[model samples]
Target: MMLETAFTPFYSLAGGALIGLAAVLLMLTTGRIMGATGILAGILQPTSLPDWSWRAVVLLGMISGPGAVLLITGQLPAVQVPVSTIMLVIGGFIVGVGVTFSSGCTSGHGVCGMARLSPRSIVATLTFMITTAITVYLIRHVIGV
Candidate 1:
């Protein structure tokens, strides 16, 4: 099979800008890094009521994003999962493991951490990129899946 990628530069740029804006706003307001998994985990096992409140709002905002798109564009964004359910589950499990080992996910390290010139975040982001590239190569060429 052949691989094809849709080059949606404008959409990608807009999305990246929004993500950066959110990270900045969250940091300025709460002095906390906007790591998605960390936010969810915080909600699951909160330290305080105030901590849980902000995390809940962030998660709610994430869930309501599709509704925001619908209001603006008159339709919800189309989502396509190219991989099977089992593959998705396995990928999620692997990501969970990575987050546990790394202490943060891509949003925290790649966006917030790098923005703050954090050495650990820089290394973690580099590792994430290298691992991602190798995984894609193996999947597309070796496994041909």
Candidate 2:
């Protein structure tokens, strides 16, 4: 079994707090849930649409925040994934497609949806979890990828 690092608990708690804060702020201020996937998809919509710029900004911050922190602190965590660039791109594309078809990504369905007690979000979240579990099992055990 893989053991967590010494900083794991602190990092997990900090991450959870940040997520909770973002969710609360978004709901209170914009009356919308803070879901990165949904925010990113909104940016891809028409430029003439209202509220697209803020969504884009939010997505940008979401992408850049960790990088900025790592840059400032000079302590970026190591990534353990051994997949090739091609496989990474393919995996990302598949995830994008899956999120699109499922109507929301895990964060949207699992976090915000569960908070709101939406039945559809509950089902979608379960589907995401189950699919992820199966895929990981296949990659690590069956295919040994």
RMSD of each: 1.5, 2.7
Tens-place lDDT per residue, model 2, 1-145, is 2324466888789888888889899899889878867888878874655689778777878878769779978977565666668878999999999888876876788889888899999999888899889987887788886
Q: How many clashing pairs per prediction, in order?
A: 0, 0
Inter-residue clash pairs, candidate 2: none
- Cα displacement (angstroms), candidate 1, residue 79, comes to 1.6
Q: Point out where model 2 deviates above 4 Å.
A: 1-7, 47-49
Q: Best candidate, lDDT-wise?
A: 1
Candidate 1 lDDT, 1-51, residue by residue in tens:
354668999999999999999999998999998998789788888999998
Model 2 per-residue lDDT at 66: 69
Error of 1 at 88 (Å): 0.6
Give me candidate 1's TM-score against the actual structure: 0.93
| Highest TM-score model number | 1
